[model samples]
Target: MRSRSWVRTVALGAVLLGAAAGQAQEGKMSQGVKAREQIEERYRWRLEDLYPTQEAWEADFKAVETDLQALGKCQGRLGKSAKGLGGCLDLQFSLTKRFYRLSTYAQQLNDQDGAAVQGQELNDRAGKLGTRLAAETAWVEPELLAVPARKMAALRKARALGPYGHFLDNILRRRAHVLGKDEERVVARAGDMANLPYTAYNVLSTLNLPFPEFTTRAGEKVRLNQAQYTRLRTSPDRDERRRVFQAFFAALRSFRESYAGLISGAVSRDHFYTQVRGYRGDLESALDATNVPTAIYTNMLEQVRAGRPLLWRYLRLRTQLLGLDKLTYSDLYPSIVPSVEMPIPFDQARGTILEALAALGPEVKAILEEAFASRWIDVYPNAGKRSGAYMSGSGYDVHPYILLNYVDSFDAMSTAAHELGHAVHSYLANKAQPFHYSGYPTFTAEVASTANENLLRLFLTARETDPKRRLFLLGEYLESWRTTVFRQALFAEFELKIHELAAAGKPLTADLLDATYLELLKEYYGVAEGVVEIDPLYAIEWAYIPHFYYNFYMFQYTTSFIASVAIAERIFSGDAAARDGYLAMLRAGGSLYPVELLKLGGVDMTTAAPYQVAFKSLEKTLAEVEQLAAKK
Candidate 1:
């Protein structure tokens, strides 16, 4: 109903989540997953910065409810005059800023401990409040659309309304799609139904679904939750990895119909917007929100599909390095260089990451230091903690927070740098821009986070003398490219196919979904060429990923990964202009469209230039991986 400045406040919370420890109380970090109470206070996030006490959070939440009535009073007044419009917007943003804080606090609290009833209740309360906010503010866009263009343009130029030009223009960009006030209200009310799929999905997947337990090679039994699945999939023991895949996917297979129903409903929700809004397709409708060209989406698909040869090359090399006759799906996650072990303690990893990111300049480095020291991160896996890591920057006034299940591995260190990139971006943008322009979209946001990851890898690569370690680093980078770039592209293709199928009036049955996914998996992994064998059971892997419910959100990972590779290469090469331009992009924030923001960061994602550079970088580093392996 409105820009994600407020609507998506909870988004930055748990996207790709990671951690380590120092204090006398932090020794538990080296152990297996513990309860949230077991984590040292120094390692936990200071959400109190947003609200020092529960009473304070309640005060703000109550204030928002009271202010929502006041905001509604100005509802019909938006089209009255410039002063009225600006004043109305002022109240709205203020309420949203406060709501964002409430939502973030509740979300992180629940995520840190899903079993806590109080945290779950707080999160549900925040959700209801968000729905109310959307329903009330839904009229703002339709009313603005009703305003005459001549007067609207003049209002945009008005000194009081100057800051709202971007926000207002974004609404006008979808002018044809904006419906009558009543129609807009209906769509706004449907927010709950639109949210049902993801909501039901999270409940079932996170809280309810019975994740199968497995015993490791050492006879240690473990419950394979999503986070554990990710961490264990990379096991060096082939038999163990196969069993992990079998047990985890078999659990989803039992609920295949339910997952299919949920995901199919997700696609149907997108289709509803497409048909109602007169969009070319769901892709058009989704991308149109951020002013991205559909060609950008299609172009990425074309480029990455054509670049499958590089993936095959890496796979062939991987097979040789692993001494396997041929690669299978399970073999993909283990280290190609088993001789190298990259583990750094949490405190030591902190220094290594800071050193890697120093090219970002002292100003950012200072903020990075503050982020670490100020407990801006929740840094260990505990009972009920959400899997994956993400950086939430929606707390415009309180600074950014990172959710990580740090396992004290090198990959976890890279994840810390990646999410910190997002934190720094939020810190810079929130500091530089106003409330309306502070929240950025995922497209450019991913670039910022990934850029930090690239810088870390490059910084490590340039310093390492051991060929095995260099190969390990190179292998990690290549794996990032595979997963973030090519693998996400394959996902994009599957997403589009499912959406198209749903639009064509076909049911997304579990059998159909499995067949479709397996087809793409086979093609993307070069299954037909005998490079890798894809098991049908792994097709349910889609059910494991949370992003499918995100509505065309996965493609940006590919696009951003490409952009960050180039951005990091330029900055690490000591290009002052490139470094400045890249940092400037983060500060620019949601003030610009996603693509234009990339241009500011010195990469044109619309063209093939960024793709070329990224592929070349991958190719170059991959060659070194081969040479290093050869040396062994």
Candidate 2:
């Protein structure tokens, strides 16, 4: 559920609105109250970790852009010899690494406080530079494909290219999909145009749109931005939760048509790429780069559908525990055991996460320690800082940067652990693999993060003796299972159905999307059986999700969470092999396909084994919680 920037050096096209860290209930700080200088040095991330100063960054920025000419000179000569190809690749990787450093620095500055105009300009410049780099280096893949398969094999034996054989082999494997020089150029040129919908969606969501303020039952006026809406939805006050839910969806419903149009454009863009690449559909088109089979996606949806009874059981248990006649959409979030949130300050959350993560081994523990001690995190919420938690791994040589508006709650601790998982993964990957292979695909990206959260749960649940407190922690874990696995699977289903309709030449109108989503919601929540009631207005929930524009990305969250459950179980059982295997998978990075690397880590996601394992784990936790509740 954590927002992530991944390996893409460019700024995110869509700024997703919700927080993985628990959201704040009000705007505690007035607008423009805190300047970047006003923050304590210890709490601020050391951007100097990447570049010592703005002057240093500017020098390198100019140098990297000029280095593109050096790259341009080697273009036509790549096929002259194996050594020539290796030299070109060496230069290419070097430039990209430097570019990643530069781009990530600008991104970190901009994210520190999103209001700084200078930061925004630098971020925009970095993005344009990235687009230019993509165009400049577009010839590499096509030209490499033009070489005979036999030549590539022979080239692998050459000492210079031997290190890159894995990368070269991947290119040759996708030979059929690689377009010719002119067509590749055309596709590359159209990249910016194809991204318009995403750009527009980000602007509309983060800046231009007006979110209404709502008054709570306490007679307090609160503005319902994305963060406030998320926080209030889980308020102990049922009336407040109801008000927040209605107001939030009402605001979204007003812009339903706009969202539909933007999302339709995104779907069409996917469809265009699918046809251009000769893939069967949009799903295959998206998965092709990672070399994952379409069956994995379909099987995940089927398995999650099969697990619906358990999902329903959990919901019924929640309703019964709350003593409600029937569970409504608004009632889904309040804690099962208590009416108040357990406050956890940032310093305490930090110690708890580090201790929980100790099971991963000492090497990882050291990385987390450095991250905290070295100001690698930009902690606390500020006047104009970006909301939510995300790890920026674009700093290749330097350490990863984590941005979080941490509130003192257990969820915030989980968010910290989740992001630190990413940091540790990147640190290990960069250390073990070369720059070219350091970045992981989105398919396996969430494994380490969610696995960390699993470890935290295992640590916390075992140590706590109070029955109600243990039940609360366990219920939160179950909610993670629901949201990360079941709920995301539902989202994956919606994405698939909508894409299918779009591919079949059906119009993606607001009514059509609303009805399709509402049906899926009913099926998943089992409204007919009285497990939960869905308000008609809640059908517009699809409009609030920014992930839909991400092009078949939500399914990976389900898959990764399931895989991590299996991985965390083995590691938590004190299995040395499992520990090493998980670390090795993180270190392997993009050198291997995601599925292959995961298989090496002892979770073969292509089969039903891991999915079944995950369900069993979920069932075990449910039984433990049920057993504890029975004692009362």
In the order shown, what is each candidate's alpha-carbon RMSD?
A: 6.0, 4.5
Model 1, global lDDT:
0.84
**Residue 576, model 2, lDDT:** 88
- The lDDT of model 2 is 0.83
The weakest ten consecutive residues by lDDT in model 1 span 17-26
Please provide TM-scores, in order, for all candidate models, with all chains considered together.
0.83, 0.86
lDDT of 2 by residue, 1-632 (tens): 37422211012223222231123221234364466678788888999989898889889989989998898888777767889999999999999999999899988788786778878888999889998899999878878888877777777788989889889878888888878778977987878778778768767766666888899777889878776887788787777898899988998898889989999999999998888878889999988877888888999999999998888889988887777888899998877887436799989998998888888999999999999999999888787787667897878888888987787888788888988988988999998999999998767777888899889988998899877778888887788778778888999999999999999999999999999999999999998877999999999998877778778877887898899999998898899899999999999989998889998788988788888888998898888877876776
The number of clashing residue pairs in each candidate reads: 8, 0
Who wins the TM-score comparison?
A: 2
lDDT of each: 0.84, 0.83
Clashes of 2: 0
lDDT of 2 at 574: 94
Assess the local accuracy of residue 260 in candidate 2 as a C-alpha lDDT between 0 and 100. 92
